[model samples]
Target: MATTAEYNLGDFTYPRGWFMIGLSSDATQTPLAVRFFGEDLVLYRGASGKPHLVGAYCPHMGTHLAKNTTSYVVKDGEHVQGDSIRCPYHGWRFGPDGQCDDIPYSPKAPPKRACISTKKLVERAGCLWFWYDEEGGEPDYDLPEFEGYDEPAWVNWNVRCLGELDSHPQEVIDNICDKGHLEPVHGSLNMELFENEFEGHVARQILSAGHKTLAADGGEPMTNDTWYTGPGILQSKMIGEFPSLMLIAHTPIEDGKVKVWYGLSVKVQNTEPTEEDRALAAGYEEAGVDAFAQDFEIWANKRPCLNPMMVEGDGPFDKVRIWYRQFFNPRARAGEFQKRVNGRYVVRGTNTHPWDNAA
Candidate 1:
């Protein structure tokens, strides 16, 4: 796999953005080990019912905080106390803010530097949203509200974790502008319209087409409006027999590897969904996952495309790559990258083209 530097993305190895680390159920009172942005991290829910993310190693003796199961601290159920986590080896307790709050054996107060680094975590929509920034800055933008979880008319998404892949996320991100793949990979038919709009940290794709995987049983064509809130957190609205708010999230596990997940929150006729309605929604979600797997399979096997061999009919791949570069560089220079590629691009060959519509 190619590295981020090989693609010439920017100075940072990983982009600064809100990434989905795991499903909400994965975080509980018991500490769980997780890796993201090329760092070992631990995730645990507090007794107060709030989830937290911190560096995996204890600051004192470099013990794997969540990796120990045989320690007395873990067996006695003292590994997690209230909202703080205790290191298994030395019993050093770190609060949610990542400061060393207590040291049981220490006669003196905790040292000034006795702390493990913490991460900013936001739990929403049954997923743990992690804000990752190399510069250690606050989130520049907010995560798009996955409101289906709260809405009465929509069935909440199951949010399946589709395991990790040994490919750079740049390959998956390129799908935003992969108009050529629709026909062959997904059996996209009669592409009436296809366009992409890039502005600020958002990259939008508008497509009107018929898909074998997504719109198989339906006679009506599907209209897909998809956008990435940042480098990760892709949300798409599918307009068809049943409208769905689809989610595709991928977080970097290492420089050239990533983990991905897919969910489809479906709208039903019921104001308050019945069991049957939920079952129907689950079926839709399965179909959506199947559609996404088409792309996932290709990304898993293909070599990295550092530079695409662009052609006349291809969508604006260069523009999409430039728009993505903003998240990798320093936030102050983000506008510089945005200004160069912020505009709507409509490619040729679709029925929406002037020549195609003519007699």
Candidate 2:
């Protein structure tokens, strides 16, 4: 497991960004208790079908909001009222803004001081993402959304929560610039072209992986355009006969461990998902999971690469590390770090991959 000292990220303990807290399906009218960034949070859906996230504990009586079942107002068998959530302990109702709106037993209006802190959240691309900042500010940027997420021709998997792993996210982020590890780590070979572009909080990597698995055919190299939005979300578009969108999100649960999630949406050939589409989607997802598992195995077993011994053909590990440092520091430090790492790249090479832009 890589410690913060081992990784040497920066002053901040956790990076600020819009990280996937859980799947959209994980939340309903009832609040679901979740923990991220080493803090407990409550996630629930409103009557308007919108998701809400707030500090887990109610300000009054110091009770966890999700555990308050004694005085819950249930309509349609759901514990939520409009966009408001009631504290089970004292029946104090908190609105979507985290301000106390009402007190069941009080004639006077709820005091302004009797409010709970709310976390910013956004629901997009079939996932629930929450904004986290060291100073409690708004989200720095928006999360990237895929094109055909909820369409009929796509088969969406329920979020595969992989529990917790003892590893820091920087170790996972390092994979973006690791061209040399592709063949060994994921069995992806024939890397005719591998390039990384860092623009602001996003890092893009284009890989021409010679067919090992997850390719539509057994012979053609797969051109994959993968990118990280902020510090947590990694989205990849695997171009093949049956193209797929890969969504991988990991958030720190502790100093050296993270809760990981895997999800994929497969584009079906037919207008509606048929049995054949389902089978193909299943196969594609299985292959992707297998490939990721290989990476996990290394992460779980290898010693921390805080200051890796870089050699030839290691790709831009140092450059990616510089880009990643922005998240671990305050705005002042991040700004300076960004100036050094933010830039564009057009890595070109010889390749017969169908999706290759360069000839």
Candidate 3:
């Protein structure tokens, strides 16, 4: 088990996953640039109706890809078609792969080396994900198994919200394990705290809660499991190992302000949603929004260090916090910590927890 005191805030990285950029309906024919993973990336549908992500800034002179204003010359100038984004300042065109394709003023094509990097992109479950590291490392870990995602038994309702917080990623993450705050902040009961584990680049915390509200009555006390992978991915599942419901949240924008995006999937039975079913689904979505808002209020007011010093008895779920630290801290990655597993002390990187395999 890891503790809050052991977490190294500096080494935390965002996990890779499809993060919703507002909503799918908002995107039209025009290209839009969104801040993600500390950089601006452009998102637009290719001719094939699939979405694509490219560097937002032109490699030449740093002009923004979205700021250029040139009208299309064909079919009454209604559509814009080109192999790459054209820079308004110098008319330099960059291809989909972020490579410079042409310079209008130059006599010949631009050098092959003149190109901005293009990130590998995918749209899944109504969200966009950019691979910050290597391509095809493994199709992202399987999305949490939820009943509503593909089954007709349950109706799935999804909601998207954005919050700007003055806290680090870790601060927001710690909220999932802070069992003490649920009663007061969320008006929920604290059932019990389970163990947390850190394995490879993934950190997980399992929490049980019951009787949070009347609507949640008669329902099983949900076991919320949060998983953190290297870099920028965060996922939360509402069921136990058999995750019947799942939510994926990501911080696409960095700097002093963090932009958080959430997508959820619910399991529904075989039937159209009735009024009661709709109300229940809506209540769940509202609960999630309110819960995150509560966390945002606290994190926004915290100091930049994000991970405040833990005092005695401050975190009853300190084990989860510590496990996250051991799993993610660069020191642990470098083999600096000895983790005990199955009554044996093993190097941090070599030992794998059951959750890691399950995830």
| Candidate closer to the true structure by lDDT (higher is better), 1 or 3 | 1
Ranked by TM-score from best down, the candidates are: 1, 2, 3
lDDT of 3 by residue, 257-334 (tens): 456765555444436656676666666667677667776777667565434566532342344444444433444242
- Against the true structure, candidate 2 reaches a TM-score of 0.88
TM-score, one value per model: 0.97, 0.88, 0.72
Q: How much is 215 displaced in model 2, in angstroms?
A: 5.2
Writing each residue's lDDT as its tens digit, candidate 1 over 248-293 gives: 9999999999999999898888899889989999998888788889
lDDT of 2: 0.80
Off by over 4 Å in 3: 1-28, 69-83, 104-107, 133-147, 190-193, 215-222, 229-231, 239-248, 271-279, 304-359
Give the range of the ten consecutive residues with the poorest summed lDDT in model 2. Answer: 346-355
By lDDT, rank the candidates, best first.
1, 2, 3
Candidate 1 steric clashes: 0
- Write down the RMSD of all candidates, one decimal each: 1.7, 3.9, 7.4
